[model samples]
Target: MAAFTAADVKALREKTGAGMMDAKKALDEANGDMEAAIDALRAKGLATAQKKSSRTAAEGLIGLAVEGTRGVAVEVNSETDFVAKNDKFQDFVRKTTQVALGLGNDDVEALKGSAYPDGGTVTDKLTENVATIGENQQVRRMKTVSVGQGAVVAYMHNAVSPEAQDLGKIGVLVALEGDANADVLAALGRDIAQHAAAMFPLALNADGLDADVIERERKIAAEKAAESGKPENVQEKMVEGAVKKYAKENALLSQIFVKDGKATVEEYVARIAKEAGASIKLVDYVRFQLGEGIEKEESDFAAEVAAAVAG
Candidate 1:
């Protein structure tokens, strides 16, 4: 006996989303070592894939910038939302995004090594901000999109400051390729970027969507169809139909335009192209939602207060 208790199993379950029995088995196998138990569960693929380190237990702003046909979006995270709203933090995010635009690369590590406008490298400036602001901060990620001919439009949802609408919780960049008039292309790009921010499309089109995501959707559809007790042929058809619907809903070009709800994004682009007298194609897009896919640690204020009073 490795001296493990029931509480250990419970904690393991909570941390890994594993079944009670599985957690118990893992703990027993690890001989009461919590870390080893977690590793065992992960090795067996029985635990959630999320790494403890990757959990973005922070709040911050998504910064976006567009210069002519090029645009960049960067997510800078802080330990608290209070720091996210700080003017200095916001300025850092904005300046970092501008620097990212110049780099024209998506590598955050490389961006950190790049120079900051004031003087030192971006990493050095960030370290200075962390020391002065009294909070742990990081430049989490960056993405850039561009078009050789048309325009790259940026949109920010729930903008922190109306005066400078480049910083927000959700940032989007849409690249439109065409030879249309600059004004017309800009207007159209704005509308499309707005739509992208609202709809949160997974990819530009069905063909571009990740194969793993498509397969996962198919599996879910197959399970649902099985539950219906239908014939084998009918079940197959049902799964296919469900997958097509999923693609239409999740793919950007196939999704219905959020602004009008009357036409697909592709159709909307065609309509705009007809009006502008130039062929416009949506080349690419990037959407960054702050803290997306990162689980935050939950705190119990009441329990903390009780414990403090008891102490």
Candidate 2:
């Protein structure tokens, strides 16, 4: 019989985006336990997503570097965005991305263990940088894509630094594999990269999407179909049809072309191939939106000010 306070209900409402009364009821159902309340909401299908904590709070730069047929994008996060604008910090991100490109390694620990120009390991240099810059920083993640004969074009959205070097807050890498002119392929790749940044497609193809994600969508669609009071056999067919539609909508190749909106992405690529006089295959793509999946710590600025004054 734990009593849930108004503040507790408000906090739960903010976190789960449920109404205040719903939040209070949820808290009461969980006996005033926040984590349990989150789980309870999930059990009742009230939450659109599961809460994930323990992600990095650090924020800095997402670097994109393309050389020859390969490109790499790495995220180096600091404690503040101000440090992301620092010249030294930008240089670190640029150089680290270059290092990542050559290493052909995706493991953060392995990249850190690799050599750096200034003597010690990459991790060691990063540590030295933290002390020198007076801000805590780390290489959060890296991804690489390459094509043997095609082009890997890159684009930086909202670039705030040098053109030839650092891109911006959002970085995209698109690899086009084909026999077309490298220049033409590069242009097409850039267009696709920009599309990726805007579209956020789930996968390159139907098979690439996570099984769990597909099943989750399947369950939801099946439940909706069942509500029609249709026969179970007919409902199964409806669910299957709905799943196919979901796959096409979420898959990159089946998605409508963002450039024209009249054709699918596959059709757009086919048009590009016809125009370029060669068959173009989108081998892979990487899109990093500054903090798409990361949750930031929400603080009460007014309360902090009052506490400082009291101190």
Q: Which candidate comes out best when scored by lDDT?
A: 1
Candidate 1: count the clashes. 0
lDDT of 2 at 152: 89
Which residue pairs clash within candidate 1?
none
Give the C-alpha lDDT of model 1. Answer: 0.86
Report the lDDT tens digits of candidate 2 across residue range 229-278: 99999999999999999999888888888897888888899998998789
Worst 10 residues of 1 by lDDT: 46-55
True-structure RMSD for candidate 1: 14.0
Q: In candidate 2, residue 187 scores what lDDT?
A: 82
